[model samples]
Target: MRAFFWAAWLGLCSTPLLAAPPQGFSFAQKDWELACDNTGACRAAGYGVRRGEVSVLLTRNAGSEQHLTATVTFAQIEHDIPADSTASLLIDDRDFGALDALDESHFRLDSDQTTALLQALTNQRKIEFTLNGQHLPLSSAGSREVLGKMDAFQRRTGTADALLDKGDAGDDAILPATPAPEIIAAPVLHNAQPVPLSMLQRQKLLPILTPLLNQRCDDWQNQAIPAADRQITLTALDKTHSLAQALCWRAPYNDGYALWLVDNAQLSKPRLLTTEASSYADGAIVFLHKERGMADCITGETRVWDGKTFTPSLKYSTGMCREITPGGTWMLPTFVSQVIPRQQKEADNLALRTLYNAVLKAQKSDPELSLNKVAEQFPLTGHITDFTLTYADDTLITTSKPSPDISDDEWQAFLRSSISADSENGKVSFTLIDLDGDGKRDLIIDSYVGGTGLFSYTGVLKRGDDDFAAVNGSDSDNGDDFDAGVPGALFSINGRGANQWNHWVKINGQVYALWYNGQFGEDNLYLLRPFSTTSQTPAVTVRYRYTLNSIRSPEKDQPLTPSLSDGDKADLLRSLEVMQGSLLKDRPASDNDAPICPIPPGTSADEADNYYSGVAVNYIYETVAYIPVWLNGKCYIGTIFSHHGAYRHGVDAEITLSSPREDEEVIGDYLISGLRHVIAITSGWKTREGDNGMQ
Candidate 1:
């Protein structure tokens, strides 16, 4: 979940400080810091940054009936507090009562004490603790901002359970808690030995890994390692794969090692999992890092191998650095998962089957077969992780496999490609997978069905002797009640609405479809079973229904429009031309492939680089081209375009501009200002007047 959120954040926050608050984030103001993890739980910590003072930690779990908890620990910079010392809480110079000792220097506040402390923090009253005849005052410089962010993150600003803004609204609408996902670790091959890279192997593999190391590892690129220190070790993961480890960086307190998954036969490229890992053993990697030099607070992460890849199994952070306890005060986990051993998985599955059958019996339904057995019997193969689309003779083609010899841009524009199901001018996407029992791969194309409203039409094409062909016969004899058929099929699963969208997730070689109706609505999970032939359409069963209402819509603060001067507009046009030229330069040699940028009117072939050479005012008919953009595990096919300008029929690639400099670059400043308005309008809050481009 964190990985998905990170990718989305990268796409949205291309520029620093110009992005909105992400789904989950760590925000800090002054000495106070509020960290809202991926699971929606929030932890706010406050202490003096310059001096050792009293520190407090406030924690609130997601969902209703979850109350806020407060804990405090005395800051000991140079000396430790006496074990027998008594402590008392004071608010505005008024002593409430003796503090309950949680440890030698840490204290837990009672309900009444916590309430008074909250009031004091909100009212700017002094909060202090008297321990061993010493007064430790807690700073309140950034408490309000940090607390407000927490309330906003939990969607409790207007609810009765809100800590900052009390209102009449009920707390029932507050975001619900999401259970952490579970990962079962595969057994490690303890008998396998680590193989040091030989000189010949190093010479063969250094070119392939050097670029990745230079980008992801600090020690390899920034600091020169001695001949004795430089080393690479590979440990066998399975018959085909191995784990490669190398030193990443070194600090005063800890050293980080980079971990990568490499194919033993060098059949595929290496994949870097992390660069801050500590150790790897028993099919798991542990990461430990100190937050401060005092070693009072630390953060830890663990990733477990689940056969296919390294899965994030645990993530936690100890409370603020108060020196009350070594390795921090409390174990505050933002991400956690149950790890089951390989031997116990079968037993776990049996228990789960019994529970599922019990639920089905309660509903008067027949006991269904074990989903695990179904997954194993019909495991999906040739699952394409990603693909690029190009055109051949005005028809869209799917390029799932690319050659390593070609550059990224050139590989994106393929030479010979499989024709898509539709040629209509709309966003087209396809994936390659073994749909039938045949070992040959098949194609599943998603295209826009022609209509006044937006609709997605999915169809399957089976592999033939030479190329992919439509399903041979009608799927009406499949004995399923779904609105599915051969060749051109609607959504494959049952109970799916017209507004719903689907994305496939592969876990342990089995493919499952997560179908959702809206941005914040119920999700239908479906498992696609393999079929013997094209005529025998794969059966779909709804495995579970997940109600997703926790993710809320962001509040819009301004409109989407840029205030650009004539000079700024000219600079933007020039910048766009340069970007378009670069794309054309690296484009593969394909005359029929669709080009993102078209040749402008009256532009010669030799002068294609200057397509936007005319005066900026002349093209004041600047049209906003809407293209299909994939973000956050969903594809948004844009249909809205400005009516004021002529619509250009081609892909409008997203442009990333550099930071603005007063003396040199004005495109970044003006373009970003315009983007701010555009972002606000498209945020789904309210549309700007006379702007019909938002959906």
Candidate 2:
């Protein structure tokens, strides 16, 4: 049983001074720091920093319960983050659980997670927690000592209960080694008692049953039913359970007989349902095993019994699912319909068997099977890790598979032309988006031709008479190798590359791009706002232009060629011809298939250079500067000189603006490129209305 974690919000004092609290017992053990008051109340703390900052504390009052609380505080957040953001916790490879924010900087963990945390600390080698995609490790150096102290503190205060103590060695709260569903064994039926009830149960249900075993609980082990339990399963009331409220059945020796009377038993599957008390207790949870494994580790079902029938309430995981991993969780698959059908089971079937049947059915019916007509039927969702879209002719391309007709020589020849390792190729993973802004989902697929680690997408599947169809990519390309080489076409029998939209927005219906790394052709922070009068051209109001390192200040007209190849310089020049457009940010591609590659020791992605080079790494970011754009209007992007003009965008927000400058607006005729766009904005209770403007 998972523990329910309880949380409490601590009032954060300004500039939290993290030192030993002034109290009775205070000690610092490795990473664990603790301070206790005159009473036995103790407070322990530890913290971590990744993309953001957070502090974790485990506290136990003189007579209160133990719980872990985390305080989140960001020093500089400029991104637009929704107030309610959730963070996930992973102890070693197991996902212990998730943390929901109580407020902008306050989050609480359910007290229930304490068991998992303790297990991970004592058994697992690593613990990683992720918030907003940033990962950091949790220190467990002094966790054992700290936990021991907490347990000791409770004992000292006379509030500890051995039976209910979660951290105790005698408690059975941790995940049992012999989990019920997967076992397969048959009970022997040689010498068996018709009904076995101990003195305790006989006293409680004397009128309902007549027991054949007359020995004491400990000695009554001829079969396996404990002769000590007070409550009993009435045979007349339930029969589906193999036990049928009966005795212990054994072979010739009639040894190793133990009662299946424990509320939480140790029996494996075949006898699990029969061993369990047929009488309902809360609800029945069934485990679903994998597609072709002896282990039950895929999905599960929770059903509620209403006397005569069982109704499944929800589906859960029996164990860790590969498809729902650290990376897989981020890249979700798309399904044809949001509403999926659940496989119905026989009314008399056990929950465990019912769940297993559902798993097998899902494997065969899911759209991922990629069957010709099956895709149109019960079309399940496919991988849509990153939201990328492309349009090649009109096809919404996704996955590409090896053609059965292609020979080994042909495949080998094809592999030589690409840069990414053949194993690093992307499947036609797809997602639906409003491609035309009409609010209807359009399909997009991976158009990432191997090489140089740059991932892009190509659109396929044209909408037609009540269906989506692929646009033929092979028709236009002409090739000399009707059998050897092919054209660089995206949809053709040989090639494909579709025009794609990299995250950018058009201002006044005109493409406007931002420099990602720096401003003024230098790395720094700045803000740019765009607004204009109804009749005039849209203008920009650029402000907050500054550098963190004043020594390397940016100059408006400086050339921006840090390093470039002749071909790259040429490609950059041609892209500037119709200069009034967005500058493309060079994003390195991810080897989604790298997990399957047999990587060598000390090998990394940096070794790969071309479309087919260093194919071993997952992802590596390459630093790029802003492009010095030259436009047709000849409006040189230079110094800031506010001209007398009135626009309804800025200046009014700041009453500190000087005379003339208050009403003057810098004409934003020149669309700025090479500037990084803002991804998020920081907001909180303190800065609710941006009261701390420019702070």
Candidate 3:
């Protein structure tokens, strides 16, 4: 395989950039495939069984007024066809008419011809073309299924604009064509600076790039390549930034270039963009891979420099190797973007990544490092003033200073407004975003409440009179569960991953937070009215519940089973025994420090075995477990938060009720003052347990 000139196959780039980008869907079956882009434009391509065969492309934009367009191209031939050469369109051996030549190998079908072709494909009739005294057959095998998906994705299946099952149904429900995401590209440098990297500069970058090189470029360790040849080529991206490129690896068809965005000053920090890049030119990292040895089909990608980092601009693929033209048949892109040229000054905004790196760097050595101290150590660029740091255990803003950005009255008001904290007991990180599209930014505080599950909470605080008010319905008198400071409005996700689960979208001019309710059997999409409230407090409604019928039969009432390691069981039972010895009819306040739910003495693991049962909230996956402990010769129900990794947190058994406290009420709040003592002592046990952690 060899590098093919993309400009030579310019005729194939006829796909138009349309206007509301969808999530984009693509499906393939047999010899046919369909692709719908973010703009809702759909393109279906079908071909013969093998490569170097004739193929057809069917395209239709998203809007209701859009019509289907058809084009056909012949297989590779030694002799070039004349520009005036035409191909006769045939449906089941019926010659509809001749198609005008698009170029040497491609032909364009008029609207009537396109309609006839669509009908033949949907009806499973034979489709062929007569060109140069030979018949070029097109398979209609998977055309119906692929085209049907296209119509369904665009919501045109029942509309007049649909290619399949066209009806008189109104086209009002059809998806509109959305514009491709626009990227602001910084001015491209014509040439690199004359000077090569000095020994000192190389030394600084060696540690930072060595790990990446070891992982991506196996050739770096091979003795065949000279040591001098394996160096990175650095080009000035801007005054403070540079682009670093090193050959990552070599493939049969192409060479991979590992690209990194480097900060000229901070050689310790570098971001890896891509390792499969081919070259960097015109402010974009270009990637091209030949699909086969013939170089007839290719896959290409372009990531444009967007001042801060490389942003994906285009992802292109030529439809199957009809071998019609050297660079494949037609342009079929999975992703597309509009690159708007901008001057360096115009694109020189402070990158959020820089701020994130600063924050992470400070916490690298000390995870407990406060964000306020981080800002003090490394002052961030932009017009930000003052800092408020909130910790995991902190109920209020622990440390805050007056801001120059707001007035004395406004600053005080802002300080008075606190985030609606969660009970998951995790540290919070705060950021600002215009969630409501009102131009005024809102505060988003994210926290990872550690347990078995890496459950997180994202609280929104919209700007109020002069401060921020919690969007978790703090002011509501609705007598909901949130009133007791319980965690509410949980981010609709489990585990620590991308912090974008709360997707805020605009519908009919109102911004609503859209999220998926991942219940056991109810996977639903819910829209939250961020500002809508009955009592001036925005509340998230809990519409889904985890009932007995959700996972088990309603008739059976099972006892909690003891699921604990021997060491954990001994420690917890001993703690409970200590509390049992201190129990009194009128328990003294000093006994609050005594551990509760400890197992009674002289009871064997079998005879005095603790029974445990676990339950998880269907939506958030937050789990709770209850265990029956023999305390003071009576069974006391003990409850604890349970999950996959809860054992690592040591034992935190809390007495939820006395023996008669059966049913599901044991999972709820119960009088357990002694449990407070268990919480105080569990930290020491967790620290000492090491590998034999408890729960």
Task: State residue 452's C-alpha deviation in candidate 1, in Å.
Answer: 64
Model 2 reaches what TM-score against the true structure?
0.20
Clashes of each: 6, 57, 17
Q: Which stretches of model 2 miss by more than 4 angstroms? A: 1-23, 49-53, 64-82, 156-695
Task: Give the Cα-based TM-score of candidate 3 against the true structure.
Answer: 0.46
Q: Model 1: clashing residue pairs?
A: 296-328, 559-677, 560-677, 560-678, 561-677, 562-674
Query: Model 3: per-residue lDDT, tens digit, 47-137?
Result: 8645565788787766667667777776664445555566888888899988865345667688788888888888888888878656878
lDDT (Cα, tens digit) per residue for candidate 1, span 107-209: 6677678788888888988888777767778788889999999899888988888999989887766766543344667766765766787776577667777
Q: Which 10 consecutive residues of model 2 have the lowest summed lDDT? A: 329-338
Segments in model 3 whose C-alpha atoms lie over 4 Å from true places: 1-20, 77-83, 191-196, 224-229, 344-695
Ranking by lDDT: 3, 1, 2
The Cα RMSD of model 2 versus the native structure comes to: 27.8
Instruction: Give the least accurate 10-residue stretch of model 1, judged by summed lDDT.
Output: 676-685
Which whole-number lDDT from 0 to 100 does residue 195 have in model 1? 74
lDDT of each: 0.51, 0.30, 0.54
